[model samples]
Target: MAQTTAVSSTHRLWIGAQAWALRRLSAFSRAPRTAPHLETGTRGEREALFHLRRLGYTIVAHRWRTPKLRGDVDLVAGHGHTLCIVEVKTRTRRDAVPAELAVDPDKQRILRRLARAYLHRLPPRAREAPVRFDVISIYLESSPTSTPAPSIQLNIELNQGAFGWA
Candidate 1:
């Protein structure tokens, strides 16, 4: 009976430690506040990370940028044998258009260039792997005035192979 109690106490301590680690990780991952729009985008990226993990993706990088590049990739994930370069767009309810539509031709061109730069830095074998571009559009619905701000609803749309190489 004493041995069983000791095991139970050890399990509880392990679970508590896991919870504490998760809390610290979350706090560290949170972006600093800036413009409201940037904050919304940061929140959307967090949401996207959760959504993709739920869908069985292994996220390799977040906000990946090279010293030679001016822009950054929102997320890099692996699905099967494909390397996905993702772009995340977040907008509030006030926006009339779908956020994915924001990745216009000019943006696609820039993303392709960045992708090339990313692949060039990889090992030759890894660089030969298939590549795909994806876009995640997140629409945040404002809560009712009576409801707390933390309860905002998110509508996320994932567009795989959103565009081809330029």
Candidate 2:
């Protein structure tokens, strides 16, 4: 009986070690890949935030999403009496499509719907404010390699009122 008890204890220890190793392996596999394209997009969003601040726009939310909503508003800001819903686009020089051209009519329609949903969640003071959609396009220089530390040049363009609520 004592031998059987010892064997059972050893079995439990082995199973625990296996589970711990599996969890570690899964976490390592799920680590985010620092791909250049993704990095460029993140950098563009940061640039847009800085630009908006410099222009005296008060940012109310970043990447705001509602539980029941299908889409998210990248940046919700206010400048004086108008509230702005911003969409950010990032592209490298090697990309065939221009950033501005990427936001087609369908995309605009989706953004407008998202903005409406966002407004519904705001207080009456903000809900009644006039709203507009803006697009920020960032063009980056093509890098020679996919190295994570490559230096790149960025040209940012702000298109205010790119689309309207109506």
Candidate 3:
């Protein structure tokens, strides 16, 4: 039993190391962010990581992409037996249309393709696990205060099974 536990712990550590390396490689390849929206998105993804962990989700990847694919998945997580392909949308303010609505039919199609690519790269066991599409909307609002530099408050919403493979 002790041997089994040690092997499990080592396996988990290896997976964590691989995920960290992937994130670092992605950051090195991506250009610097200057736009306000881009900055907001970066912050949103960071916040989303914490939010998902609080919900008992194990993050598998961040900014996952395939060389042949044109787009990237904002986050990939696992909850129970389900594999979650997460898309994150961030805005300075909530618009008339909900942020989740942005994952329209067109966007859903793209995500589906990306998910397929991601699954192909996974090991046989995980590749066959159930897959789910999730969307996380983050709205950043400035808190009303007397201070010159008002703090930003984040409103995060997680929509599990946001879309279907069909």
What would the TM-scores of all predictions be?
A: 0.78, 0.71, 0.79
Give the runs in model 1 whose Cα sits over 4 Å from its true position.
1-32, 148-150
What is the descending lDDT order? 3, 1, 2
Q: Which ten residues in a row have the lowest lDDT in candidate 3?
A: 1-10
Model 3: runs farther than 4 Å from truth?
A: 1-33
lDDT per residue for candidate 3 within 1-166, as digits (tens), equals 0001123545556655654575567556666667877777887887687667656678889999999988899999988778889999988888899999999999999999999999998888878898999999988888889999787787999888888999
How many clashing pairs does model 3 include?
0
Clashing pairs in 2: none
Clashing pairs in 1: none
- TM-score winner, 1 or 3: 3
Candidate 3: which pairs clash?
none
lDDT, candidates in the order shown: 0.80, 0.74, 0.82
- Candidate 3, residue 144: Cα displacement in angstroms equals 2.2
Look at candidate 1 and tell me the lDDT of residue 21: 73
